[model samples]
Target: MNKTYDVVIIGGGLLGCTSAYYLCKNTDLNVALIERGMLGMQTSSLAASLVTRGRATRPLIDLCVETFEAVSELEDLLGDKLDFNHVGSMHVAQSVESATAIAKQTEMLRQMGDHPVELTIDQAREKAPWLSIDQADYIVFNPKDGFIDPYRLCAAYMQGAKASGNLDVYQSTEVLELVKDGAKVTTIKTDQGDFVADQIVVAAGPWINTLLQPLGSGAAMAPVRSHYWITATDPLYPVTSPVVILPEAKAYARPEVGGLLFGLRDQVSKWAHPTDLPNSLQGFSFDEDYEGWTALEEAVEPFLEVCPSIGKVDIHHYISGPSGYTPDGKHVIGKAPHLSNVFLASGCCGAGVAISGGVGQSIHDLVTGQTPRIDLTDFAPDRFGDFDPYDEAFLTQCAASRSQKKAG
Candidate 1:
C-alpha cells in the first residue's frame, strides 16, 4: 500500500469491491481496499445470489432495481460476462396469511412502476409443472428477477477499479486496528503496515463490529448462520427454472446448474462472533451443527405437496456461511456516529449481492460529501445505538427476532 491515500476501505466483500469500483470510476480520490482473505469468497461468494426486486419497503425495492441495472452493465464495464440469468422469480404462498402478504408486496411493486403478476395455484402450476402448487394459495412473479455468478461480479468490480489508475487492492492483508485521533480516524494499522487516509469505510460483513468496538462506535449487527442446499440434478427443475420463494415454508430456491439451490431461514437464528471464526472462508462452515437441518426440514416439508420428488432428491451440498444482520432486519449504512470520516456499510441480512450496487453507490456518494441516491433513514449506522458485540444472549435474541420477521 502507499504511504498515505485519500481513502482506505476495509473488507473486500461485494460491498467493499463495488464501493471501490464506483469510488474510482466516479471520483478523483486515491483509494485502496484491504481484505483479510480472498475477495468475495466469504459471505458474498457463498450467497445464493438471487437478484429479486420485491421487498417490504420502497428504498429496498429501489436498491434491488438499481443493483439489477448495475449487475447487467458489469460486463461492459469489466469486459467479461458474469453468467447472469434473468429467468425471473416468484414468491409462492401456501397459506392465507402469506398470500395476503404476497398481495401487499405485489401492490407495492406495482406502485413502484414494476410489473409483478399474481398467479393462482393453477396458473403457477401451468407455468412450472414441477411446482407442487396445489397447496399454494398464490404466487407473485417478477420477470426482472434473476441470479448471477457472485464471485465473477466481485472480480469485475475489482478489475474495473484496478484499471482506473487511482485504486489499489490488498488481499490477504488483515487490518489490526483503526487509530482514531480525536473525532477522526487518522491511521489504519494493518499486518503489512500502518497507512493514513483521509477517510475509512468498513464493509467488513460479520467483522464490522469487531473493528468498531475499539473505536466506541460499535453497532448492533450480528453474524448468524445461513445455509442453502443443492439438490441432485433433476430434469424437472432445469436451468430455466424461475427463482421460487415459499414464504409459508420459510424456504426459497433458485435454479443451480441443472439442479435446485434450496435455502431456509432458521426458526431460532444461530449466532457466531468474529473471534470464533477463521480469517478466511477456505475451510469454514456450520457442518458441525447437524441438528440445524431440523429447521430446514420443517421449512421445506410443505414443498413436498408441490413437488413430491423433493424427498428423493439427494443432498448435493449444504452450502453454509455466516451473514451479518441487525435487530431491525435492515442494512446498516451511512456515516459512523461520533467518528469523523468513518462510514459503514454492512448488515445485509443475507441479500448483499442483490443490493450491493446501490449500497456501493450510496457509500461512494457519502464518502465524497454528496447526498445518497436513496433515503438512508431506515439504515443509519447509529440508528439503534451501540451494543455489546460479544453479548450472546442479547445478540441471539436479535438474531432470532430477524428469523421471526422473515417468517411472519
Candidate 2:
C-alpha cells in the first residue's frame, strides 16, 4: 500500500511526538508520525524527568524555560494537568571547583531574570534531609524546577496532536530507507508501505544515522548509555522533596514517593557501537556483562556523602537507555545542510525531557517556513564539522560528553 501526507515524521519518540503536537496546534498540515514501536517507549521513557531551568548554557536554559511553559500551556489546552510538580531543585557544591560552578550557574540564572535563591547549609538541610549539607560549601535552590513522568508527557503531546484532527500516528511502523529525489526525500520505505510527503523530519534520536546515512547526511551524535538506580521507599526521602543536583559528586537525586531516584556520571561512559543498537529497545540492551555494577562502584562514592540513605535501602531497580549525545554536549537541531527538506533534532545529551518543547517549536517553525522564535545557530545539525558517525574516535568523543556532564 502507498500513503501520502503533507509531512511524515520519523521516530515517534519525544521529538517527533512533541513536533506533531506543535504542528497540529498551530497549522493545518496533515502529518503522520512513524514509529518502530510504541510512542515514547525508548530513550524518552528512560529519563529521570527532571525539568530543571538551570542549565550550563543560556540557550539551553531558554530551552528549559520553554518546556516549563509548555507544561502550563498543555494543561490549559487540554484542561488536564501533566505529571509536572513544582517541587523545586537544590544544587549542592562539595568542593571549591563545584562551588565556583554553582556560583556561575546562579549568576546565569539571575542574569536571565530568574530568582534562584541562595541557601544557607541549614536551609538546604531542612529542605533535603537526606542530603548531607555538612559536606556542602554552596547551596542554591530554584523553586520552579520539577520532574514529570516522561511517558505521560509524551502521551499528552500525542493526545494533543490527535485532538487537532490533522495528525495520524502509525505505531510499529519501521522506516527502512529514505529514498531521495533530486535534493528532497520523496519516498520513505517503511516495513508497512511507502510514505510520500512534502517534508520529512528525522527526529529519530540515536538511530538517526541509520535513516540518513544513505542520503550522505548525518547528525553528529552517537548513542551514549545513561542509567539510574532507585532506592527502596524510606521516610528520609519525603514525597515532596526537591530535586537535587550535586556537581562535585557528579550525580543527582529526586524524590519518588518516599523513595529517591539518582544517577551518576561514571568516569568512563559507554557508547554502543552503532551496529549494536537496534530499532526497537524491547529485547535489546547494552551488552555490559556486569550490568553497570562496575561503573556504579566507581561513580557512587561521592554521591553517598550527600545522600547516605542510599546505603540503607535495597536498590529497587536499575534502568539504562541510550540518548543521542554529541561531541560538544549541545543539541543538534535545524535543517540538514545538504538535505533541504530534512530537519535533525537529536544530540540532546540526556536533556531531552528538559528541552522537548523548544525543540518541537523550532522544528515546526522550520517546517512551516516561519521564523524561529529564538536563535538556533548553536543547534545547527552540522556544527561540529563533517565526521562519520561510525568513526571510533568520534564515538568516544560523544560518549565523553555524557560522561563528564556536571549539570543536572
lDDT of 1 at 107: 89
TM-score versus the correct structure, for each prediction = 0.94, 0.96
For 264-365, candidate 1 gives per-residue lDDT tens digits of: 777777787767877776567554655446656765665566666678888777777888878888888899878988998888888898988888888888
Candidate with maximal TM-score: 2
Report the number of the highest-lDDT candidate: 2
What would the per-residue lDDT of candidate 2 be over residues 1-408, giving only the tens digit for each residue? 679999889988888988898889899999999999999998888899888998766778878888887788888888998868789999988788888878887899898788899898888878888877565678899998999999999998888889875998999999999998777888999999999998888888888888887688889989998888888898888878899998878898898877889999878888887767886676555765436676678889888877777877888877788888899888898997578788887888899999999988888899999888857888998887778888899999999998888899
| Candidate 2 residue runs with Cα over 4 Å from true position | none
User: After aligning candidate 1 to the native by TM-score, how far in Å is the CA of 108 from where it should be?
Assistant: 3.3
Instruction: Please give the distance, in angstroms, between residue 265's alpha carbon in candidate 1 and its true position after superposition.
Output: 1.6
Report the CA-based lDDT of candidate 2 relative to the real structure: 0.86
**Error in Å for residue 391 of model 1:** 1.5
